[model samples]
Target: MMTAASSSGTAPFGLSVLDNALTGIGTSASEAYREVIALAQLADRRGFQRYWMSEHHAMPGASTSSPQMMLARLTGETQRIRLGAGGIMLPNHSPLLIAEQFGMLSALAPGRIDLGVGRAPGTDQATAAALRRRHDHDDRFPEQIGELVGFLEDDFPEGHPYRAVHAVPGPWQAEQNRVPHTEGLPELWTLGSSTYSAHLAARLGRPYAFALQFGRADVTSALRIYRDAFRPSPALAKPRVMVSVSVAAHDDPEEARRQTSSTAMAMLRMFQRKPYALLSPEEVAAYPATLDERRVLDMYMANTLHGTGSEVGVALERLHEQTSADEIMLVTGGHSREIQTSSVELVADHFGLPVGA
Candidate 1:
């Protein structure tokens, strides 16, 4: 498969943000989502390339589980920036559903929709079973991807069962006065943390986004695999990559550490199957952490973007140099909304992204 040509429009580097919509210790889910919308709006104004949300299920700390619904909601409120799921867990739902959802979103927002798909279920086995209702669909991911893109473009080949199925609100024509987007369908990307996914995205020739935020895989090697294996497709002529990283940006290193503690703790707890709302900085400070607990936390947080804005900018620059990533999407949040918003503003400002719109 082929990919579209290089999409570097103007900027030397692309900056984006990922919001987990963490439920602060004292805040309710409703309030937390409201804060997520605010954060998305801020990123929109700050000129981030895309505002992507992660999908997590059955987690008390993370609220975003329905990326399609969130994309629809954010589309109306946001004016310019692209709104999308960081990577919708493809195995959790039917490709037709995803195609239809994103089709409607593309209709609603026109040029501001992105569809990044991942093979992970984004939840525990029990929760994944509940969502998928079956334990045998994981192997169908590649076929599902083809079905999804086929539905979106109405490009199914003859003898295909889904050939006659037209995704509702399929590609729309631009109004007479409003100029239309040449690439009418939502921008498609393959998201992953390993060379397997990178190779898949490369072979498919679509844009690739590497998830370094929670993944322990070798980012540099994964990206190199993507680029080295890429074959031109109708959708893309050159390989493009996006690398997402965990970020905790603040002026003081100690402050940064404190701010990121809640997230670090939450990650461990989630893995331990003991999810809880985000802890406050005070709670994290006073909580009794055993030596073993402290060691685990340290190991869990060993690879993160923790530093001031300028420092983070330098780190991202080095990453760009190392991976040749076209965009750097910062997955920042956990302790509080203020910290999340500030990190977004800081990264935007440091990157010299267009702001004040």
Candidate 2:
């Protein structure tokens, strides 16, 4: 369950950020990382509920391959905004290691850490093979989630084979040593773009985050399934839903649309199995796309909310009404730092989010 501290200020629904740390055609990966810090600080001061980063592997365009490392850096950069993995692709790593990493994060910023896990590989099949090295654990996602939760909670059944294994610097460690520590653990959330994840989250009674930005799943139906099938657990008493949407907003509507074109083209290239590199608006404008590619670009743009800040705000409100989501997370489109920062500020202002909080 979300605490008042984490959910405050945004009254009707919480507003948060999900960053991919995308590098533009001319930008370096280091610069992209620095921008991420700046954005986190800006979001922290502007009162966004949470600042989360996604994990992707072998994507030259996306620099956030290790969300844990970035979040560790954020523990000192921001004072209030919650820091989290928008999601960690769990099949690529050990559940025990993730437990330890997040446990350390909890120690660094108690009551301000979120661990959202997904079943996807977050990479191509070849890269997934390279990461797991013949494990092929995608089908074992549910069991891995269970093992992760058990490690975090330190409550594995006595007969379990791994019952003796404990994640150090975790709850179990603190209790065993009677060490004085902070009062909270990393809040676990389930991330998905389908009803399967919704059902799993419901059965486990964890918060659910639907990735509407993926544009491949029905958000409304998945959220409904989650709510209808929810069963309370010790971690959460009722269903909590967060919907993430792609957005590009600015004071000037045309600039907003232009900003979205870069990401739209990037999505188009991704569909073509080409390198998913974010191009500048100028480059996107000069590209000669085929009819089929144009269709894909148009479809991508149609799914993204783009316009003036007020227009985007209204669209988000409509989405909230449609999905009855407890939180709305913005995955800002485009790779321009100025546009990204401006969109967040403008939308924050439109929503009347308190500043300097």
Least accurate stretch of 10 residues (summed lDDT) in model 2?
1-10
**Native RMSD of candidate 2 (Å):** 2.7
Q: Taking the tens digit of each residue's C-alpha lDDT, what string does model 2 give over 1-357? A: 221122224337888999888888888989988999999999898888899999998877788899999999999999988999989999888999999999999989988999999988887778888886346586789999999998988889999998999987787788888976564679899999999999999999999999998865799789989999999999999999999999999999989888899899888887777777889888988999899988988888888899988898888888887998899999976868678888888888788866664
The most accurate candidate by TM-score is 2
List the candidate 1 regions with Cα displacement exceeding 4 Å.
1-11, 172-183, 290-292
Alpha-carbon lDDT of model 1: 0.80
72-171 in candidate 1: lDDT tens per residue?
8888889988988887888887888888888788878988899889988787888887885466676887888998888788788899998777777674
Kindly give the number of clashing pairs for every candidate. 10, 0
lDDT (Cα, 0-100) at 157 in candidate 1: 88
Best by lDDT: 2
Q: For candidate 1, what is the TM-score?
A: 0.91
